[model samples]
Target: MSDIEVIVGRIGRAHGIRGEVFVDVRTDEPGRRFAPGGTLRMGDKRRPATLASVRWNRGKLIVSFAEAPDRTAVEQLTGELLYDHVPEAELPSEKDEYFDRHLVGLVVRDHTGAERGTVSEVLHLPAQDVLQLDVDGEERLVPFVSALVPTVDVAGGFLQLADVDGLLEDVE
Candidate 1:
């Protein structure tokens, strides 16, 4: 199996007594990632399990594992993160879109071509995606938007942000 695992979801509280659990899906392609019969690795331990069923309730994804049969079994998986081994060559098909793995570790530059920081991580939020930057040891968050982040040169290993007031500057 590939070591490149992508976080697909996190197990939430149990929904019923039949071992079904709510999942906080992290991937954009939930239908494909959380499909039935799919193999998912549970938590940091990378324990393997197969998806026995997947359904939606009130717009939330509910999933059950073939290995878990009862509420007691699924309860143990609460708060556990789910991951799928994805190939490194696989990438988003959108022209400007990028995966969190691809965005992380890239150099962050300003509009004037001045280096600002490095992308420490990508935050997937409800409203939109955010970029966490390690700026001179301090952490700063920049929304992943075309208005602010105008350029993304993945091959060049850097992304440029617009020089907006208070965007990356110190606010007094």
Candidate 2:
């Protein structure tokens, strides 16, 4: 399986007077990702960081790394992004759920088999995920939902979209 580095968290401010620091968790599976002994690459340098301890304060995730033993050391790590390398073959446990990377390169077509565009990016908004389509060099954003994106065939390398008026407006 190919490996993909995913951002799991970002180091926040130092917590209390120890090396423990608040983490702005980015992954849904924080328990598994931030579990003690789990190794996460820290920052753009990709420094190896082993989780020494993890706990929750109120609703915030507080973590300490084996490499950063004291407040001084952990403070330096503030604002650093934590990344976890995982297999690209891994799929979401639930059906129909797709990782952004999986959809990025898929061809988008209309229901009647009209070629439309290619998915270039996936934008995660508070309400829902949005697909960024590159149609004839023009960019369009489509909300990622069953109503709009009716079908997805990752293996087939394509996805079918429902023909809503104005959806493919200026294109055809």
For TM-score, the strongest prediction is 1
In model 2, the Cα lDDT at residue 29 comes to 71
List pairs with backbone clashes in candidate 2.
none
TM-scores of the candidates are: 0.92, 0.85
Q: Superposing all C-alpha atoms, what RMSD in Å does each candidate have to the true structure?
A: 1.7, 2.5
Q: Model 2 over residues 84-156: C-alpha lDDT tens digits?
A: 9889898777789887778999998988977889999988777978999998888988899999989999999
How much does candidate 1 score in TM-score?
0.92
The local lDDT score (0 to 100) that residue 59 gets in candidate 2 is 93
In candidate 2, how many Å is residue 23 off? 2.7
Summarize candidate 1's per-residue lDDT along 7-121 as a digit string, tens digits: 8899999988998999999987788788899899998789987999999999999999999988999999999999998888777866788988889999999889999899999
Question: How many collisions per candidate?
Answer: 0, 0
Q: TM-score of predicted model 2?
A: 0.85
